[model samples]
Target: MTFRECQRCGTCCEKGGPALHEADLGLLEHIPMSDVVCLRRGEMAFDPRTQSLQPLSAELMKIRGKDRGWECIYFLSQAKTCSIYSHRPLECRSLFCADTAAVLEAMAVPTLSRQDMVPQESALWDCITDHENNFPVGQALRLAKAETDFAGSICSELDDLIRREIHFRQVLADRVQAADRDLWAYLGRPLWLVLLPLNPIFSRYEHA
Candidate 1:
């Protein structure tokens, strides 16, 4: 049987929050920065088309998951309703599991990046840029692979980088009086957590 309208089963919402696109810019005011996280370029993330984790070609802002899990933060699971149905992101509005043509086409369009979300001249934007350049996930993942499979001598360097990542965010937070949630929203997740999937060794540095 073909379904004509949404069943509100929450299947799509449970998979993960939709990636923000240009059309969703107007809705940003309704969505708090603390609820967003930039999936930086080169970071490995779930690719719906491929059904596997693939490195993102470009940075895209996504609604952070509930309690760091993949469930869309705005999804009201028990009630089976959207917290912001009136003005959900473009991907959300476009998605239809039965026929994903609309959603796939929406994915082809340019996504909203960190620069698009924040003013280019602001200190906050500068800090985000610096963090991306200085602590890139690709470089960290490469270092982790080397440590796990090769010389293992680079452990110290990787450890140092992890510590620097913590300090970098700490100093920026103190200077700007930014809260931890805001810091995560602006700079993406911590390096240690991001690297955890690549290597279990990084788990020890989680609290560092």
Candidate 2:
């Protein structure tokens, strides 16, 4: 089928929300921070353009999905239309499933980060920075990919780290008075959830 325009089929929105770009900064006035999520750098996320998982080159702040699923929060499932159609992010406006050139080009552009969303002088920013340093995702990835478990120590250590991280996230949320819906955006997804992409390997280690 030859496609020339968007049919508002909800295919794109159903897949996932778009990452915000510099041009979409102004749209933040209407979009709540709770509706966004920060994919930390070095984290493995599904790249729609490549249709596979890849480590992010930089931090990416994107809209959170609905009910913890990939469907865009703004998508009205029954109507198959975007609630914020008029003020959608740049990536949303550039999407054309039939001719993805525009969307692919848009993906190449730099994305907005959590740092950009919070004021540098704010105390919450300090917490964010401290959290990033205390639980560097890159370090966790290295440990997970290490050549040997050595008496299952690596897995043991990782299990502990995961537990500590969970506690830390809760503490941070309390300190910032952030709701559960907003915690993912404020601190990134849980370490265990992020490690899910490693699959049977991580699972094996967990059980070992």
TM-score of each: 0.91, 0.86
Clashes of each: 0, 0
Give per-model CA RMSD: 2.2, 3.6
| Clash pairs detected, candidate 2 | none
lDDT string, candidate 2, 102-162, tens digits:
9889988877887777888998788788889988888788777773853444466677777
Cα lDDT listed for each candidate: 0.83, 0.80
Candidate 1 lDDT, 1-208, residue by residue in tens: 8897898899999988989888888998899888888887888999888889999888879988887577999999999999999989989988988899999999887888887877989988888878888898888887877775543334777778888988998898788888655766688888888887765666676566
How high a TM-score does candidate 1 get?
0.91
